[model samples]
Target: MTNTRSRGAASRGGWIRQYHHPRGDAPTLVCFPHAGGSASAYFALSAALSEGAEALIVQYPGRQDRLDEPALKDLGELADGVVAALAPWTGRPLTLFGHSMGSVVAYEVARRLERGPGPGPAGLVVSGNMAPSVQRDQGVHLMNDEELMTWMSDLAGTPPAVLADKELLATIAPALRADFTALETYRHPEGSSVECPISGYVGDHDPHVPHDGFLRWAEHTKAEFTVQVFEGGHFYIEDQVQDVARSILRDLSAFVSRRLARHPLA
Candidate 1:
């Protein structure tokens, strides 16, 4: 699609970073990054699934190439913006994978996309987040800089080097705070559900969301639902990228095949 003079390529370039685009007929996997995470985090997963799928990773504002732009402070605004940007890419089947804060963002995006006349996602994969119905009043976003760092230190996935470096921490602090505020302030609308199948990936040792919270994901999707428990903490997928990518590709390929079988012309 890049070699041709098409507006789709230009439109997609705004919020998406295409790390690997293979030459073949395959579905696209639109990946959402975690809080304080960038699109580059999925580079390895994109490379691993290069043959099976095209990975378009999201690059939110105030990070990496778009550091000058202000970060999005509202979950609904972020979802709406992403869904609008994705209008050009819904011509083919698409799947979504979101981790941590990305999970909620992905779900919101899916909800918005399904409401429109455009093509809905084939499936949704949510990781490291409890169901939307599970409410908590953790105001980590309102914490002072030192308090926020202390909380981050307690989390299993943060790198010690990044936490220890005052310069780097200052650079990323704004975006991080914005993301936390978004999540902290979010309240899921009652009676909301999506038509696409939903899958949950949970870390066995994650204290944020327990098994019951993960299982509650089944309540939000009318279609099929499944869950996988991996060994580790919040960022467990980082330790099992190959396995996670393989599983996602398998499920998405099966979904595409089913869709084709249902409507031979699709």
Candidate 2:
């Protein structure tokens, strides 16, 4: 993929950084990051799995290597673009892993790919987000700027360095606001579900989504379903990512094993 991308002379060089062994008979596991995050955050996760798998995390624009580009709003615009970028690769069995705002992005990506002309995902790994149909009850757009800032402060998952740095904040705030605006406007209808295997995980003390909301994710898929609750707060998976990675590998093993039994490749 690098040579193909390089030959085309992409402006960002290798926009898709290879974080894991790119070669193997194993499956491909792609990760999407939370809002205001990038691929670098999961650079170490592939090692934590140690599974026979090749993993790559998508680098959203307006951050890190692609910082010069305009940022994606919420999951919809992001997924619309991602599905096109993924057209070349979705021929193989696919698995999506996403955290927090990333979960919504991953879900919508899967949804977009499933609709038009792409292969189905082997499975989906969603963490730290509420159910698909659940939107933020407290509207940040309705709130004043100060109230919104307070909400951001309470989340505390966004890095303090970015929040405090006026220079960087000037660049990041517009993207952040766009992300929230998209999320605030997002709404999944009742019984609207995905067609792939799905797993949902969250922390015990997460304030964003309740346990029942996580459980309802089971209704989204016809394939195997798993819901796990770890011990911590909303951002618990940040430090406990190894545990999340292990959980991903476990389900991915099953998905890949079944695929190999059928296709015997990819």
Candidate 3:
């Protein structure tokens, strides 16, 4: 699932991934990609949920058109920026879906939105990552260029062609390194938690994060918490993308329906 170029005003931005399906008056699904991933990573997800929701993919700095921009190395800072960027679209309810490093970003962003202003995310779907409160020393950012690439390959997120092409690898390494820095350095603030319901998804065989890690996400959310273990490794969504999408839409639709029932337009 890669990005296929589209032309439109919404598609042209350093922050928005243009491959979204704009559902008129539908609730929005905001997606954040994994470490070293671009918005295109969620292109398939966006298309899958197009009819039911407006899927918006976030484009983090140091990738694609944002390549020239300096990548933020702090998770909080990245979340802050995302909150501000999405301020204009707060009229409707939102659901956030993030994978791996993106899970951390989505968690933090949900925390901010819950405490600061506007409607909090209707729900949060965290995939391929442990709970933010679980502290682990991931020193991948500090590794040498060769070591970092090798580690990413082990995670199986990087394409073989991209790894084999020296020029391409060099071009993307800086962003990858910066992304790792953000993930490794993130620390959940003391007593911080989100009020929104949380759903955690993990691969049964994912070596990087186990079911225990995913289960711990329950502690960080004050609302309902559920975990779904799928079959595969770190990038399990590749095999169950539709299942993931359906689960997301089901949860989001239920929440939106309840919200509307309580506060229908006068």
Flag clash pairs in model 1.
none
- Expressed as tens digits, the lDDT of each residue in 1-266 for candidate 2 is 33454224222333454555644356677788765567877877867754656676777777766777887655577887777766556767788888887888888888776776555677789988877786664666566545655676787676777667777766656556666766777787567778777888888888877777777778777676788888888778777878877888888887767655765654
Q: Which of candidates 2 and 3 is the stronger one according to TM-score? A: 3
Residue lDDT tens for model 3, 45-160: 88888878778888999888898998888888889988887766655567888999999999998888877657677788899999998875678999988898999899887889
Show where candidate 3 strays beyond 4 Å: 1-9, 261-266
lDDT of the candidates, in the order given: 0.82, 0.72, 0.82
Model 3: weakest 10-residue lDDT segment is 1-10
Instruction: Give model 2's TM-score versus the native structure.
Output: 0.85
Q: Residue 241 lDDT in model 3?
A: 81
* C-alpha RMSD for every candidate: 2.1, 3.2, 3.8
Candidate 1 per-residue lDDT over residues 83-202, each given as its tens digit: 877766776657888998899999999898788876678789999999877875598888887788777777656789989998988888888888888888889999999888898898
lDDT of 3 at 155: 87
In model 1, the worst 10-residue window by lDDT is 1-10
**Candidate numbers, best TM-score first, in rank order:** 1, 3, 2
